[model samples]
Target: MGWLHSLFSPLKKLWFRMHSTTQNKGRGIYILYEDVKSCPYEDVHVLWSILVESNSASLPSKK
Candidate 1:
């Protein structure tokens, strides 16, 4: 138990740092449920990008 705690302590700190950085940059992660025909070049990016739905139907309504 002690060894496990020692090993994971550093990992936990690293994960927190990464999560905080992502939040600070105002970037979010998402999973695409289906394939899309096309998307804007400026919106869709490989990493740390803001997800924009080309179709309004695919997006959830804000209450």
Candidate 2:
């Protein structure tokens, strides 16, 4: 496991930084759901990104 993880240290850092929403802060760890209310506990991003949404708006204007 150590060897495997060593291979992804860069990716790990990027994932944590990007997805955590705030670098070096614990806001990434169940903080919203555990500390706040009025926010949906179900809607959360587990990682930095997911499947790309089709760029429907990027299509060139119709003729």
How many angstroms is residue 52 displaced in model 2 relative to the true structure, after the best TM-score fit? 28
Error of 2 at 42 (Å): 39
lDDT of each: 0.58, 0.54
Worst 10 residues of 1 by lDDT: 28-37
Candidate 2 total steric clashes: 0
Superposition TM-score, candidate 2 onto the true structure: 0.27
Model 2 gets an lDDT of 0.54
Instruction: Write the residue-wise lDDT of candidate 1 on 1-63 in tens digits.
Output: 999999999999999999899886554222341222244453345322333535455778899
Error of 2 at 3 (Å): 2.8
Least well predicted 10-residue stretch by lDDT in candidate 2: 45-54
lDDT of 2 by residue, 1-63 (tens): 998988899899988878766643565544553544444443433321121123345567788
